[model samples]
Target: MSKPSILSKLNSGVESSSPPMAHPLRQRVPSTAIAGLGRSLDDLAADSVATIDPALIDPSPFGDRLEYDEEATNLLLAAIEAEGQRLPLLVRPHPKIEGRYQLAYGHRRLQVLRILNRKAKAFIRNLTDAELILEQGAENGGREGLTWIERALFAKEMEGQGHPSKTIWTTIGVDKSGLSKMRAVVDTIPDHLIRSIGRAPGIGQPRWQELVDALAIDGAIKRAASILQSKEISSLTSDQKFVGLLRALCGQSSLAPHSGRREIRSSEGRSIARLSSTAKGDVLAIAKAESRFSAWLTEKLPEIYRQFLIEGATSTLDSERPATGAADSDGTMVVISQP
Candidate 1:
């Protein structure tokens, strides 16, 4: 027997002579089943992974992360080299250029692929600017995550680009209060200072607020400039550099003497004490000493002063008293009367 055509089978609403498993009855299929099939095809299209040349993929114009750890990147590169890329990156078709794509996230992975001279496995989607930001923000938040200052700067950048606060909050996975605090840090801290500090990963809102308060003091900017210019600050890691700057600012006020007294140094030129001429008396301020000698000196000060006083009085008596020396029953005696 000849097989029936698919169109004729659909039109006649009849089962085909072919086995049930060989040909599905189109007429018997429900509208819901057809819809489900269409959805499955759409999903497959959306989820299909493709390997594309790294040169064709441009970084997201709205990328949030500013700093990447060298060691972490090296580790990632080693992993990809040994185990291959386990996850695919998300990217959108380049809006302005043909035959190009823009990354929404997975910048590190893309960089590794480029360095390896290999193609990037990515999920291509048509994304709007808002959608791009959302996807980028979500991926970053769910992953290793941006530092506090990084997030602050990102929020500020988004605001500068005219994105609303609600959108930014959603993207950053923060509430209104958290967004406000982040913005406050970005607003209060100077741009040069922030750039000098880099991304302080573990630093939080309170420490940032402390930094802002420190910056409000007079000469803070100059002090911060001096700190950034120092070799020690330059040698520190990003997080350590931030902490060094903060310590410099906070310590500036304490290091300056309130009494306007000059510090006194020991014979070795170490500042061991300070001297201030006050209306009531000459105030002698000793520098903080944590040594055993300091503890011994503190304990023996009273006895030493008492002995000094006794020696001074005896010397005065000897100098002023008349020479009246007589041999007593057992020894010589000198009786000196008070003048």
Candidate 2:
């Protein structure tokens, strides 16, 4: 089918004469864009708020990017077909186009209407950019609240828009402590884990955050991702051990006093780790295993990290790494070093 001219589609004659002020909201188009097209609302056809083609409308401008379920869409389409346009769509002027409108909210509703081939019942509003953002943010929030990834993206967007992180904390209704934790979680988790976090059974933000922080260290995220994906870490004991191993390797807490210095060697052929004889053999074994694991990770870690970027998982591992520093003293201690 031929696409309608932009002017014809948006410049319906509603603006030929100003309507009553009571409505406060009405259809509008850029005067310059549609100046030559003399159209009136009367000249355009109006369906009974039903049977209007919804495909003409576009997606939400906020980019919440909802995971639309076909079953839900079908149900909503059926309901809307039966009930007609009972709900009103909220929209704003498209940022890129002077005359085109963008869906600030009511995206799901609009989608269902489109499926039903009905005219979307909509409310026009003159809203500032800030208002549009807030409206769309809240609209996308809906009943289930935002996923960790969604929250991260939303918070990042808000930050970019000049809204302070504290404002987002307040706007999301999370306290300072909770907000702090969320930020840390978003910044520390591996993308793979972050994307899987909310949907992963029995995993919560606190635990996920802790894991993400640990995984920020080299190869930690990849190891965790592999264990989780393979279902090897399904039991509580496995989870605890995995987290413990990560803490031992990545945690910044002071290590126990040990006489021997631990050395980690990174090579293209194979990872080799050596520790002083003063260190217990058990500790040496752990360090050797860690080195081998690091080698395995050097080969596999990037693949796991790729899963995160493609999935848009909410987990974030801080990309920045601190300088290498380790201290040793005379005592028995455990060291897990990755090559």
Write one digit per residue (lDDT tens) for candidate 1, span 1-339: 444443444569676686557666577544433444344334434467999999999999874766677777898999999999888888899999999999988899998999999899988888888767766765675574688888888778778767888878866667899999998888988888887777777788877887787778778878887888788788777767777677555442222232335565544666655565322224555657725535654676576557646667556554223222223344422122222
Model 2 lDDT-worst window of ten: 36-45
For model 1, the stretches where C-alpha displacement exceeds 4 angstroms are 1-47, 252-339
TM value for model 1: 0.58
The candidate maximizing TM-score is 1
Question: Best candidate per lDDT, number?
Answer: 1
In angstroms, the error of model 2 at 171 is 3.0
Q: After superposition, how far is residue 84 of candidate 1 from its true place, in Å?
A: 1.9
> For candidate 2, what is the lDDT?
0.51
Error of 2 at 299 (Å): 39
